[model samples]
Target: MTDRHDVVIVGGGLVGASLAIALVRQGVEVGLVEAAPAGQMPAVFDQRNLSFAAATVNALTALGVMQQLRTPTGPIRRIHISRQGDFGRVRLEAQDYGRATFGQVVVARDFGEALEARLDGLSGLTRYRPARFVGFAPDEAGHRALRIADAEGERTLHARLVVAADGTRSAVREALGIGVDEHDYGQTLFVARVRATQAPDGTAYERLGDDGPTALLPRGDRHWGVVHGVAREQAESVAALDDAAWLARLQRAVGWRIGRLVASGERSAYPIARVVAQRLVADRAVVLGNAAQTIHPIGAQGFNLGLRDALTLAEEIARGDDPGATSRLAAYAARRREDRERTLAFSDGLARLTANPSPLLKPVRSAGLVAMEAQPSLQAFLVGGAMGFRGDVPALCRGEAA
Candidate 1:
């Protein structure tokens, strides 16, 4: 006899786990399969800083996941954007929008640990640890028959809907023959935690220069999380720098906005890229999270976008219809179209425009920022996008149950 579930989520990362919780709460039988063993942290859940948009926080709060976080999070009360050498500067404050804060920044590892802590408590949800998804086939009943390999060897499972929440290199997406538009930015991002001379005071800084954008997000009370983007050719050399040298380089790139960087933590670097799947849904399977689309991390939209993907799909599944029905998945894809397109464009455009060294374009970019600062409507638009308020807002995002 084959094990079965109403929905089988193929990845146990943040989005997949969140989706499983959402579905299980609705009384849907969910099976979560992860390649890593239980309690093991993946690279996605490292020391990198994760800026959760306000909408994302609401959604996670509604799902009861936010309360599980053991580590402290830094509130982003204001965002300061500027260029290396330009008169253009834009500042957005949460109070301007009648909110206490725009977003919250948490270490990725802490958030992952919170998600892991709640996984076992979810009713009607089963977790398959250290399991690899081998393949899938269509069953006679028009469902998905999944083959998963674990310590006990290959086992067959069936699901009404097979969700691929796997990371960028999703096997399920590949199995479905889904094509993607991939762009390697030829840049690398170095992330680290550093203590600055001045207290964070709930301010986040985004500095764009000829090299790339350097973002310093508030981490804890005394520490700030640094995301320094550098050319791919020089990434190795930059990453090889000692803590003092790295801090010095970061200080020069970002200026004296945050004061001297006194202490630093372990640094890690990864190449940056933009990837969007041609199709989000296929047959009885659907891809979510990084599996569906991987955006540039400039605005910290990647995980927030993925969280929305999970919640929206959950809403569709909660409709009590056939989870994998063509119409259902189609609706999910349609609902996500506008948000996905807009976010991809915004992130991609920002990465390109900010990193472009064309002196001619510098003033144009600065002028745009200056204009946005002067226009209340334009500022609101920017705030809305930053808060993850695009397209049809989901119930969870509004702090309502799905």
Candidate 2:
């Protein structure tokens, strides 16, 4: 059997789902293929908390994705970044920059539920749930043929544009003949919800070191979300620790920043790796989200960057008749070039620079932090990127429809 659509997106995770919402709103026909069955969320949709930049909130709000959240989200009004044993630190307040909040933190599972809800009964959307992407066949003029398998059976899907949002180990990307630059940071990040002696007070804290970076983000339930990074060699031992032992380790790593963490919820661990696609577009297809690039989680730019990719592509498709035209794909690539490159560099550089154990980098790191704290221009630049206002931003990122 064969199906047809304006766009066929593989991997209906966060980015693909967002793109569907955005494109469907523009009257585009979309086929969303997801491996997970309905009401049974994938492993990717877990209890980890995500730090949404302000621009992300704007874009998501514009797509009507934020309105369906079941749980409350915590706003980040302040950010505190310092290196372990460093003499200087940088503190940024959204109010000082004429903004009420930098961004909101939403639990990954809650956001996944909200996305599923928002996708309910949407026009111009055909969901192929519990479907697996087999591979791509020959192209038919401007359209590409996709082989997909589901409960019913195998079928062919013809799409004007095929988007691979399948994530870092993207099978669709491999079929599309796109190469990636991979980097293993040798760090494993363990995340969980924890209670501290002092409440979060709307501040997000990050302490960087070669021993591994520790971050405490505000959560909706008056608890802080802790992300403790450990060296790759020690990940197994760290993951096997009891809750009490883990909390104690966290307390030691972060000091008394948010006070002692007295308790913790369930824990999840993910190994850190950086993967950047050589090209964003190939033939009549393209990649989005982690399929296009995966950065170090230190700056929390992974999803934010991918969300921008979806929004930008949506903007291009909305403004043009040929959604899969080379011109349109080129335009999307062009629009994303500066933002993607800059954000990737920013995250990668921060990860490497902060984690370097060499004694020589300490002063340099301290000076950078001190400079950011003292100079309004430096702070503004930092805040602007954190707000997702960098490069050729799409209209949706500014709270406007494309």
lDDT of each: 0.89, 0.91
Off by over 4 Å in 1: none
lDDT of 1 at 401: 60
Error of 2 at 160 (Å): 0.4
Expressed as tens digits, the lDDT of each residue in 182-291 for candidate 1 is: 99998999999999889899999999877678999997657999999999999989978988899899999988888888999999897988888999998889998999
Q: What's the true lDDT of residue 249 in model 1? A: 95
TM-score of 2: 0.99
TM-score of each: 0.98, 0.99
lDDT of 2 by residue, 269-387 (tens): 99999999999998889998999998998877888989999999998888788789999999999999999999999999999999889989888988999999999999999999988
Question: What global local distance difference test value does model 2 have?
Answer: 0.91
Residue 13 shift from truth in candidate 2, angstroms: 0.7
Q: Model 2: which ten-residue window has the lowest total lDDT?
A: 393-402
